[model samples]
Target: MTEQDPQIVYVVDDDAAMRDSIAELVDSVGMRAETYPSAQAFLDVCKPRHPCCLVLDVRMPGMSGLTLLERLQTQGAPIPVILLTSHGDVPMAVDSMKGGAFDFVQKPYREQALLDCIQAALSLDRDRQNQRETGHRLDQCVSTLTSRERDVFDQMLAGSTSKEIARALDISPRTAEVHRRNVLRKFKVHSTKALIALFAPAPAATQRAS
Candidate 1:
């Protein structure tokens, strides 16, 4: 990626040497790398706008990597995090995954393995960004609907037929059909099935819940 539109890889470790080394590795792969000596230092800076992921040391001086991960989650930040841990810390790292970390790598990690993990984290962040953008667009479309049309929209989503909607709304079937058509037009979908698909919860979210 070019400098103007580069993906960012943030490296946060209390150890200066390790932090610098991880930054260098990320930079070598053509992504923009920003280094911080502590988790708080990383949080002090403004959040990155471009697609990004975090490479965090599991043990830090002030704010531990797990604490930072929890803070990010509480704030609803979408950036994926890959924790760096020692061999003995594997159990904690696995727990971190359950806590929303993208992944973790053991210290003395293979260079290629860490790089691969970072790439996957970046991909996940991109998917999250896209989902948010699409949701915003759908919300805008919904906002454009008239009150009666919105009622029709909800009914359509609930799998209501024109006759059923007419009875519920105390309107004629022909009038209900007209509102339904208007709702479809506003959503830019040819069919109710397509509109339902657009508003459906993402597959990843469903999987996580299951």
Candidate 2:
């Protein structure tokens, strides 16, 4: 990660001791940590520019961890959350997973186990960040296309031959070929197949093992 936006692990728990311990563990691994006493505090100031994950206690006083997770989901926040739960909160933790939490760790958890979950969450965030950046760049490239060029680009993606595109658009084959080349050049790809691959959505991330 770049210094301008370093990796971060955010800990949100009402228990001050638990918050401090998690912060220390995150720092020990050379990543930055930010601790909050409640979900509201975290929501008030959290604006993460880097790849990051949240470690949230399931039963905070004001706004519970699960509530916060649902709020984030509604806002389309992309940060992965790992819920911290007690033994009795297992059902809620499982529900959180179905609600799109990255993972959950039971209280009295082993240090290495939590660390493993943090690392996995961070990795997923990084992949998401990269995908967003790539999509933005592709959007810029698409914006540079002329209306005719965009039509040609769409046809190419739809597996239309240059001659077929010309007939569809009522343009000469030579003009259609020129537009095709321009589309390929703008996308920095040499062939239509490569262009299609470039525009393909990334595979969904694998679920974490239980």
RMSD for all candidates, in order, please: 3.3, 1.8
Residues 96-142 of candidate 2 have per-residue lDDT tens digits of 78889989999988899999999999989988888888999999999
Give, for candidate 2, the lowest lDDT window spanning 10 residues: 1-10
* lDDT per model vs. reference: 0.86, 0.91
lDDT of 1 at 169: 98
- Point out the worst 10-residue segment of candidate 1 by lDDT: 201-210
Clashes in each model (backbone N, CA, C under 3 Å)?
0, 0
Across 134-197, the per-residue lDDT of candidate 1 in tens digits comes to: 9999999999999999999999999899999999999999999999999999888999899889
Question: What shift in Å separates residue 162 of candidate 1 from its native position after superposition?
Answer: 2.6
